[model samples]
Target: MSTRRTLLAGSTAALGLAAGAAHAAPSVTAPQPAAAPGGRPPNLVVVLADDLGYGELGAYGQKLIATPRLDGFPAEGLQFTDAYSTAAVCAPSRGSLLTGLHAGHATVRANPSSGARVP
Candidate 1:
């Protein structure tokens, strides 16, 4: 097989392995906190930068590009270093983001592999 085909096959296999492991693992649910004094919920901003690797930021290990915006946002808000996207591609990654659901629970993961404009 060609190198491109080999790489694609490897990536597919890796995704399958991750899915299986996630399914086999026991589920743990955190306790819900009581509502605050006011009825309004906290404001949230979820930012997903496409094609960004973990080491692409100054907070990680990048020493080349300057990422002052990213470096400051987490400090002003919340910083979740352990968060992960369900897929390694844009379309599916976005599906999870807008719906507040995992890629495994969404139909988009199985179709159009990646890169579709959000409706």
Candidate 2:
């Protein structure tokens, strides 16, 4: 992975996408937090970018890096435009994204330098 570290991990790999989850930290001006009123269970932020590619950000359009808070996660979280990763490295794609099992039945399939210990 070296076209200058894949353009420096696709230019410092960032995808914020934390919009209005009760506007605690994801602020555009703060004060728009009222929706979880019925059963409640929505707020989620699960961004994991190792090599970084999914149109490289700006909420998957990426017009030369602006990414206004990762373009506010498809208007507030949950955007998986045809996702696919079960190991291009990163310890078997984080052990099949924490144990769903894909990267050869997962469990740290690689990325252990030369010691590689996870028996």
- Candidate of highest TM-score: 1
lDDT of 2: 0.63
The weakest ten consecutive residues by lDDT in model 2 span 11-20
Q: Per-prediction TM-score, please?
A: 0.51, 0.26
Instruction: Check candidate 1 and list the clashing pairs.
Output: none
Inter-residue clash pairs, candidate 2? none
Error of 1 at 107 (Å): 3.0
Candidate 2 residues 76-118, lDDT tens each? 8657789677778776886666555667755567887877577
* lDDT of model 1, residue 19: 65
Candidate 1 residue runs with Cα over 4 Å from true position? 1-41, 74-78, 110-119
User: Model 1, 2-107: lDDT tens per residue?
Assistant: 5433645665676676667666646633323346669654454557788888888886778999998888866676565776667878777877666656688776
Misplaced by over 4 Å in model 2 are 1-39, 43-50, 53-55, 59-61, 64-88, 100-106, 111-119
Q: Native-vs-model 1 lDDT?
A: 0.67
